[model samples]
Target: MTDKETYQRFIDWFRRTWWDLPESVHLHPMIETYLTPEEVDLLTNIPHSSQGIEEIARTKGMAPETLEPRLRALANRGMIYESSREGSVRYRLNDSFFAMLRAALWPGRTDEATKNSAPHINRYFLDGWMDQYAEVHLKGLRALPIDRTIEDKREIMPHEDVVHVVDDKKYFCVTTCPCRHRHNLDPDMPDCPHPTEVCLHFDELAHYIVNNGLGREITREETRDILKKAADSGLVHGVSNWKDGVDTICNCCSCCCMWFESFHKLGHSASMDASNYRIQVRPETCKACALCVKRCPVDALQLRVSPQARNKFGKAAVLDPDRCIGCGVCSHKCPSQSLRLVPKDQAELTEPPRDPREYMKHYLADRKAAAAKNQNTAD
Candidate 1:
């Protein structure tokens, strides 16, 4: 095969691996922007799953030792994940393009390629994800709030406590929000004034970020401190959609978040389901301070005419279910505690797909079925 075919094959493999990802005509070129020609050839050598190099070595007519530098280079760049199995080292490609994009942005701790390529990479990556919006779509982080934010009459579950998730972690790492960082990089985009060191990582993910130069490991107390500041800034506390053993917490503002900006600014529909709880309003208690309105990331809460509103504001906080992400952002900011999170109509809040890959597979199947039915109807 020609070099062009070799590169195309690698791109095809990537598309198949990220099966849910939308096709970007510029994706292959964007990849070329980072990886050198030799590196691209090396990537084609690495299979989609974990494998030891001994067999590949024999096929290449060289010892695994000869490939060690290349293998280590790829692993250090966070392209392939390294693991130990039965005391032998094996490798596999990293789980998702989201992870790959970060590793690509940072390049290496010392690498200078990204100094200029960062802009191109960020722009192309955003475009690609938007083009194939669904496949590259993230299971959005669901916002969580402190117990004090809930109204006194509201039912608060121990499991629903945001701090509980924080306390349960054996490890923590703080990183700059990549979404915010990407925005700040572009001269055309408005700079985000929010604190940058607010991304909270946990467990194996913490270890991964620390090892990959994506984030710095930090003390638990520091982690808690950042969370506090994030709340004070009216940033939403969100965890990954995984219901159990969650590994991520992001303090998001609507302007800079991957989910919100894509939906609100870029015109891509948010593929994420709302959290289990939807926001509620007690008009009688509301001050209509519009604090919630200002803090609401999704414009879900509004100030409307109210006879019971306490001040000259002459309005009360009201929730529009159609607009709420169930993120609880408005609830966190309401001084009168008018907003509360209630278990969403279980029927309305369905479970998030376990992971992107499975989500894509299921999405394709559903689409195929729909298309077949439509064909029958047309006949």
Candidate 2:
């Protein structure tokens, strides 16, 4: 293949792997900002599955001596994943989603390209890529409440405790959040002020981030501190859907985070897997302070007069079950102690996805099946 053909080949493959929306949308222009012609050629050589030096060295018309340095360069850039054990090297392009985006945004070593490429990348990613992502049943991420914020008096499930989740893991790391990083690119736009280095990773995923130079190793105490700081800043907490492969704790703010803004502001309906809980109110205890009303990400809380609390002066905060996603933001700040988390109806409870990879499989399969059945009825 010619050089242009080789570059286009990588684009085609990337579109297949990363941009799995409707065929009408074109992402090559946005994608090229992150991967240059040289980078694309290098990517086309690496297998999706991990392999050692011999396989990678054979690629791009180079022997091990010539290719080893190139492989190291790509590995350092987070373009590919590498694993070292027992004196052997393995390479693969395992993480291509926001992982590459994170690689391209961090201001570490070759950060100048990432720095220059960010605004174009952010514009399309925030506006265009997100629109496409929302159209698909991409259940790659979900909200999890900061366990302590949910009230010590409240029932805490194993999944509910973000700190417990960290303590359970032997390995952990923290990375500068990609969303916050992207938001700070433009001096013309007023950037968000929420904390940036709060994105947490665990286990092999933690190892993956640290080993690839994308993030730093963090202790369990440091993990809790990050979570606490995020909560204090009114940031929403989230994790990927898998129960076991729960590698990330995303501390997100509504102003810049896709997990919050896309779902709450952008009205993402094609998404799946919200928090396993929702908020309820004790109308009698509700002083109608509107703390919950203001803090709620979804505008799920509203104040209205309560008949039971005759002459309690004003109105009481009422729960809107349809609007609430059980993030625990309102409950944390409720002065009158009105708001609390309650389990959703059994039918509405979400079963966790197997892993990030399997999340798309199950979510897309269900969506496709639903669409087909709807079409049959229309016919």
Question: Which candidate tops TM-score?
Answer: 2
lDDT of each: 0.67, 0.69
In terms of lDDT, model 1 sits at 0.67
**Number of residue pairs clashing in candidate 2, backbone atoms closer than 3 angstroms, sequence gap of 3 or more or interchain:** 0
Local accuracy of candidate 2 as per-residue lDDT tens digits, 1-379: 7756866787566555543422223344445666678778877747767787787666656688777777777776767777776878787764445444565444333355665555665555555466545555546667787575454435556666676677788888888887677767745446888888888888876786787678899898888889888877777787777876687888877666765656765678723346878787888777777777877766778888887553356688887787776778788767766777777777988767666677768766766776687799999
Pairs with steric clashes in candidate 1: 20-135, 22-132
Worst 10 residues of 1 by lDDT: 104-113
Candidate 2 lDDT for residue 304: 87
Runs in model 2 with CA error above 4 Å? Answer: 1-7, 18-29, 85-87, 106-110, 126-128, 135-138, 149-156, 187-189, 264-266, 270-272, 308-313, 364-379
